[model samples]
Target: MPRFAANLSMLYPQHDFLDRFAAAAADGFEAVEYLFPYDYSTQELRARLSDNGLVQALFNAPPGDWAAGERGIASLPGREAEFRDGIHQALEYAAVLGNDRIHVMAGLLPDEALRGKHQAVYQENLAFAAAEAAKAGITVLIEPINTRDMPGFFLNRQDQAHAIREAVGASNLKVQFDFYHCQIVEGDVSTTLRRDFANVGHIQIASVPERHEPNLGELNYANLFNLIDSLGYSGWVGCEYRPKGDTHEGLAWLRQWKAQQA
Candidate 1:
């Protein structure tokens, strides 16, 4: 079955975290994903998932200074301690929620004083984090945010993600390929996906032009998903889009469109 994860951040912005979680389960979604679940207790969140019979698919590892507009700092210099602490905190939540992967958003670059020395530190920290994640049976993912969409992000291209994965040298470290961002930054999504199939770990999408529901967007999700299925991808597909109205009302497109995929 193709698991659908309601992006609580965009889908149910108006609802409390757990309420939307319950709603996702009620709507027949077997899995759920959230951008940041730091505000809720893993135990309490886990209980809700259990009661609703939903799988915890994925969650963020924490992007530092979300409020200060700092974006993230995983690869930034002199902040290795902060970065590792964030990963540890994320494991606690992910372990409780039964989530296997963590998205580590690459934060903004540090001051030029540390520029030459910082990237080495970033790679080393990633290797350490990956090793730790492997011990916990959890995989750590690095997502590249396109500069066109989100400027000042450290990793803004697939090549950067690929380099990080290669440097980590751990099976547990992989790249998160968000199609919407990839399409905007670099077209030919299928070719890039196929080329990096081994290293690409997770995917998220909204749509072009509107960044809303899938069927209304330009990208042919049916063909895209067909390609994914043909690749024997058994992983989940995250419905990480903004709902036009209530999240539930926007989701009717899911059942309405996928049925035609047959």
Candidate 2:
């Protein structure tokens, strides 16, 4: 069975951010992931994970000025220093939290003409991140988010991401494949997964179009989960979806999926 990690940023919205750790654990999640851990101290976050017996599966390196709409700085020219600082900060938190993977978001790019320049910057930044992270025994990740959801997101296609990984040529740098984004950007998700499985370092799931629980989507998660298991993927599959109703009520899918494995 594929291990599932509750995405605390999207799940357990009823509780406070810090409290979501306990809620996810109570619901039988062995691991948890969130967008950023910068808001809380490492000690507080680590205590929550230790207390709940939850593994810190994944979290993002700082995205520049989230309130200012800067999704990430790695792909943005002139922000390289800030981006490097963010990576260092993220690594500090990862060390304390016992996390081995970090996702680096590609910021918005409104200018089509600047694509080449941005791609160059992104690749260079990723190379830098990978080298720094490798020293800490950590892997850096890049995710391709759908344009509809994040209109200007730099990375959008699976092939594009893999190509960037190849160009970067960093062994510890890999793709963070999200099914929701894959389905939105490229319809043939399973085929893409199979083709890009070797370069994939992490996985995530959500319903198509609505980004709800996995069971409600156009995608048949059962088959996907089985495929992942068959591929011998042992990494955590992040449940990165918002609940349509109560979070606990929406978890019937997870419960059912786990039961099937039993």
* Model number with the top lDDT: 2
On TM-score, the leading prediction is: 2
Model 1, runs deviating above 4 Å:
110-116
TM-score of 1: 0.93
Question: Per-residue lDDT for 181-218 in model 1, tens only?
Answer: 88878878888888888787888877875778876677
Per-model lDDT: 0.80, 0.95
Model 2 agreement with the true structure over 47-68: per-residue lDDT tens digits? 9999999999999999999998
As for model 2, its CA RMSD to the true structure in angstroms is 0.6
Q: Each model's TM-score, in the order given?
A: 0.93, 0.99
Q: How far is candidate 1 from the true structure (C-alpha RMSD, Å)?
A: 1.9
lDDT of 2: 0.95
Model 1: lDDT to the true structure = 0.80
Would you list the clashing residue pairs of candidate 2?
Answer: none
